[model samples]
Target: MKWSEISIHTTQEAVEPISNILHEAGASGVVIEDPEDLVKERTSVYGEIYQLDPNDYPEEGVIVKAYLPVTSFLGETVEEIKVGINNLITYDIDLGHNRVSISEVNEEEWATAWKKYYKPVKISEKITITPTWEDYEPVSSDEVIIELDPGMAFGTGTHPTTVMCLQAIEKYITQGDHVIDVGTGSGVLSIAAAQLGAANVEAFDLDEVAVTSARLNVKLNKVASTVTVGQNNLLEGIEGPVDVIVGNLLAEIILLFVPDAARVLKKDGYFITSGIIQGKKNDVKQSLLQAGFEIVETLEMEDWVAIIAKNSADTKEG
Candidate 1:
């Protein structure tokens, strides 16, 4: 099928609002290019580990895109969307590709497409990730557990954020801790937490794909009974006090949700956060402090930092 690929370019500041504008302007759906996801997920694992220079990357803006069929009855549809988008977003909007062909793809092919991209990933002496297509034999002495075919979503223990979260879980999580993994993309951190002796792991993300992917990952890891994955925002839909909260998201979102997290965490509960750029470390620290938490330790790896902190008793005293 032929699709009119309407791609709009905007500044980082305007990406979200412009996306909303584009949706109002009558498009099918918008695809926002979040470079932060790639920076936090892909680059830290595959790209340079300890020395990520964000400036070396693009100014890091999203492409708000939607599709219109060639046979659509809307005349000057692109122009209408463009003008409405321009009014909402003060930035210039470059209409990228007009028409691109799309084909119906099957689930098997789509899931296995990453096979060529994925190889046997050895994160630590304890955990090794092997794609489903490949038959990998592990030496008996390695003491390595296998995560067979992490399907598709994110997180295969290969991304830096996932690696960092797993390492943090392995290090700090105690037995019988109720763990909440907000933005549980592919349920990597939650599953890791469950495996690491978290009593119960409740995981959620905004993306349905992420929820499905997370469930698949949990099943792949055989932690389905321990970890629960769903589509929800950071601790908002979840009730009760969790002992530990692990969020592998951009630093800004972490700061925004820390207060709620503080509310949902039991007194002295730990909040382990990663996906923070080196430059944003101090900001996150200050935000956590302001959110009524004490920074217990900051783990630095590959130019990124994961902060482990405990909630203060006086969080609600204000």
Candidate 2:
């Protein structure tokens, strides 16, 4: 297998924003590591005491990495992967005084090297994610089951953005409530809503791959009928008002779609949105306000934020 390592050395404060930019720019599965975490482990005995110290540490830095499979990313020569790395400078940031570097890993290894990095991620106490190829046993009592093969789509429930949306739905979803999930990737949010007892749910994604993956995941969990998967851009071509609506999308998309969300939401319905980076929560909130939503609650996990807003009768929509 061949891989390219693109390392961005920046102050710890910029790590989250940089990661978000990279993700929005088409990088998959970004892994961020604070320089302090790389400190070497040591054991010494002083009156039965043990100690660990750093061998060598940069004053401040973080390694944000995006790993891709060789066959999918590099192929035979890996020239495309190299180009992809070079094209990753899409982020425009005033880094004070820092430089980013992209390099290639020229080596020969087995094809499945990066597969070991991914493991079953449990979204909640009752939910355990088992890859499509893996065998899993779902307890008869628990209603949660998520089977996924994250091919190229996002939101496999490992990222903070996905987790926040799932947590919000689990906290408020009631049995037999109608639910709608916009920009549903891999159908994680909708599946969780279904498992949590929403009577009927419809999930849509702009990407065809995401729609396909979401459909497979819905079937994997045996909730295909209750949860409809379709190809739509932000609820376009969908009809009717649902009891609860969830959108796991970037802050910009959330703001742009807030009015449309209000248009289809029933009076006093719930609206949950995530994929918000730091310093942008207020922007989404204001958009929601202008669209006639009353703020219910907001959640923050790591650098991602999710807002739960309620549609009130006082607001008018186009």
Candidate 3:
């Protein structure tokens, strides 16, 4: 079988949304190659190692790549993806170079291209994410392992936004707590919450493809009984009073449902939000404040920010 490799040269800020566009266009998997990774300082605490090659990355903006089978509708699909990415400007997202290119590869090459980008990495103190095909051994007795196959999903659970959310969930979640995971792509957060001892987890995603991918992941992690996956727009129609709520989504999307999040969480319950760029951090923080949430902690990695807020008892529930 032949596959078309679509590569987009864009800013790091646009990676999330652009990858979503590719997935919606029926890409089998997405791979991100950022030149910064070649030079960024990695912590040695987890003994993380990288074998990145300078030749594989662009000198300036990040490159997002996705693989699509050579189908009769491939041309139309690519055009639609381009249009979707351009429309992101309305949301104040930076496109950077935004140059797109395409090439052909056989099935064997396509399989190896993306898998090499993912590996077992310890994102938090106790949580480590590894691709399903990797045989990873836990470095510690209490280490939590999450095996994920990106499939048609957006991330491998190693993205900064996801890392912070998983860390926050580990810190705040009490045993047997009920967790509501908004924008639960790949269901990584939901699976982590369950592994950390959450009795019940409700994971919601607006995209049906994501919902399916997440459900499959939950089952693979043996958390299906604890984590329920469904398709829902943000927090709409979600009845909460839950112990914790976690959303790793765009700041604009996070702002849309601040009040809903506050209403859904129980008094003093936690809300963990990420997928926010540095420039929009203040906007999300202020919205959380106005919605009766007290900013508890802020986690930043590279250009991304994740906020951990607590719902105030004075905030009225819906």
lDDT of each: 0.64, 0.66, 0.87
Compare the candidates by TM-score and give the number of the best one: 3
Q: What is candidate 1's lDDT per residue for 123-202, written digit by digit as tens? A: 55355556566676775564345464443322212555556777777777898999998888657678767777788998
Tens-place lDDT per residue, model 3, 110-169, is 887677677787877898888899888898999999999888754322677777888898
Pairs with backbone N, CA or C atoms under 3 Å apart (clashes), candidate 2: none
Question: Each candidate: RMSD to true structure?
Answer: 7.9, 7.6, 2.0
Model 3 stretches astray by more than 4 angstroms: 43-49, 154-157, 313-318
Compute each candidate's TM-score over C-alphas.
0.64, 0.69, 0.94
Residues 1-318 of candidate 2: C-alpha lDDT, one tens digit per residue = 455555565544355445545443444445454434334232321011112123323456655555444454334323443343344334332243345555555444322333433445566556666567656666557647677765543221266677667768888889999999998877888888888899899998776656777898889888887999988879776655778999887676788778878888888989999888776789899988988899999988656788999998533333
* Candidate number achieving the greatest lDDT relative to the actual structure: 3
**Candidate 1 clash pair list:** 49-302, 50-302
Residue 293 Cα positional deviation in candidate 3, in Å, after optimal superposition:
0.8
